[model samples]
Target: MLPTRYVRHSPPKETTTSSVNEPKISVQVLVLGDIGRSPRMQYHAMSIAKHGGRVDFIGYQESTLNPGLVENSLITIVPLQPPPSLLRSNTLPFIFAGPLKVLWQIWSLYYTLGYQTKPARWLLVQNPPSIPTLFIALIICFFRNTHLIIDWHNYGWTILAGTKGPTHPFVMLSKHYEAILGSFAPTASFTVTNAMAKQLRSRPYNVRSPILTLHDRPAAIFQPISNSEARRAFLARIPETSGFAAAIMAGETKLLVSSTSWTPDEDFSLLLTALCHYAESTDKLPPILAIITGKGPQKQMYLDRIASLTSTSKLQNITVATAWLTAQDYATLLACADLGVCLHKSSSGVDLPMKVVDMFGAGLPVVGYAAYESWEELVKEGINGRGFTKSEELAAVFEELFADREGKQLARLRKGAVEEGSRRWDEEWDSVAGRLFGLCD
Candidate 1:
């Protein structure tokens, strides 16, 4: 299931926030849970504080740490933890986890809203409306006479169901909640594509304000690097390419794929399996390294399965590598690779992998599985990289990223990512922050 969230409730008839002379209106915006060490949350919190207002964010304990740092901006990091698992293992019925999660959500909403002595003037929430927290947040706003902003990072149920395949009733109910809450609260939101924004508009109660999806990064990252220093950079960042020696190698080319995990979804398996097929067909099986960073529900199971596949196939070419690194280092590693690959479990049409944006931003030619139309659209086929939604399509992109036309064209296509970042995404955070804090208004 998707993580907990703070939802918006009924709109207020009137608000007292009109006076411009009001000394930086104290805005207490509470998220659904604690900030789980998410840099995204940190970035948002900092953005609010930058505007000289008080910002508070609540999220799960794993991602959101308490006692967070807030400077001049209106941001605070609130923390929370999931209730202990009632079942001994993850094999329990979805009905159980689903209800348990909702209970926690209810608790969070009550704690944040029912207890607020002074109602916050504005509330910011993610898109899923089923979250009691989001609904409770809206109640706080109504009582306090504030405004709301809903953030749609991705489709939670869509991403999770991609891996599990076929949803349980609980999952369907979760989606129903998402639809209801999303429709109920009107606010500015994030959309990966214009098509998605259109779908949101079709919703019965989607509040429309502004839709800003992922944008480009700093131009410096994508700037050209001379061939002379290319090898130096890749070799220097050896940690990223740790599986180089042990992974499968076909002919002269080495195949590599990478992905990160979210709560219920880990979407790269089909692509990885497809890459495995590619290795099987070729005469020379160069090292095929599958590197995964970060953690999620299926991480351990994935590692064991890949190792089993390698042992059974009697090919020493495939190896699994994992570690944690700073964002810059992660992007640097992508820059050093012979190719970049992203996988999405088919169900995950809702989420636009932030890493995909990062990959293109890093000047890496990305090979992504087309789970969302957003990624498919970004790839433009044969330009940035390729998307493989099915078992048959993976090897073709693998051939491109490793050999065929892909090898020779890598430099130019990779360079495109850098320009996209600088012009499209990275620097805009300041503008976004400014607007969120009411500086531009």
Candidate 2:
């Protein structure tokens, strides 16, 4: 099991002579995607700002800045021009021009950083467009005398390999290129899980830098909600779910919530198939209000599939509703749910899903599809949640949890889920911020 205690580090004690000479710390965060979609980056920026460091954020202008971030005086938002049509549309030109576009953005970043009056203390960058951006950022930091911090979610090369096969020339080239660049000295390196940290340590590159594990934690925004409040908020957010809302109000339905990006990594069909099996095997099942949230490339395809299933009367007792939700609405929906379903299978088999963490924060028990070996640390079977590897097994789990008319099993799991959520990362990001800023003495 993963340790429950948060990682803590004591900063070096300072003498009176050195105390007067401490320079003001500043950080510049560079990302190639939408800032709003990048929650980890947001957390890093907020952590730095909260610890008295000024932050300059550079990213594309596709999404609005978070409302809280907009009002913060310690942070400045510098929007980059949106990528060209070919890159935005996911077309053939993207494969060739994507690196060039990232290079161009880094060039733009150089000018933005050059215009600053004070030299930044740290340059924090997210990887995946890893090699080219890292190569350029390292050279820039070398000349500017700034420390570099690379946060690894997964390799961009591995994502490409998933589509083009592991032996593809591009994949082979990326692996070699990343190794050469990643070996250079950096202030610190971070990954999302202990398993991923192990993978980074075992790489062929001779990186002497500390590789830290920083799992995703929910912000204070998500909290448990009363059943009545959750049902009302869910209905307000998704009016099309009136039938389900009615059932909820009548005390005749159980709410099942699942959040997805609708991407290839998550297998939504598995959940659908399990639902079908559960519906067919049980006769007097309670009405279920299943809400699936988020928008992505495969959304339309899944919507069509759901429509087809409903039209054919495959799932009779279950009412499935899919909608895109705002952050507040999403949290409220989760807070009200009796059970949360997670279908994420990591693309690199390393990164854990932030969605599940959000669910835990709301004290909702989960039925998750097991994709990684490290999942047992968080989703303890029959404790807070259950994990299944097959459709039949998942269906059985659903039956075991909800099929009890007395709600005894679900009440037990719910209590455990609340306890787990309460203990989910007891330490705040302020400690991480203190370590990054050399604040501890």
The model with the greatest lDDT is 2
Tell me the TM-score of model 2.
0.87
Residue by residue across 1-441, what tens digits does model 1's lDDT show?
111233324432322343323324444444453454344445555545544545556665554132334433345445545566664357667668756767877775666554533345556665433356556756666555567666665555564455455466645755666677666554556555555666677664364566655332332333333463564545444665643523322224353547566344445566556757776765543455656677667778767777787778733455667767655455566655556676654343545565666666556677766766556546656666666667667776565555543346665666655545445332565566346546445
RMSD of 2: 6.8
Candidate 2 per-residue lDDT over residues 334-414, each given as its tens digit: 887778999988666778777887888887888898867668757788888888878888888877776687778777777
lDDT of each: 0.55, 0.73
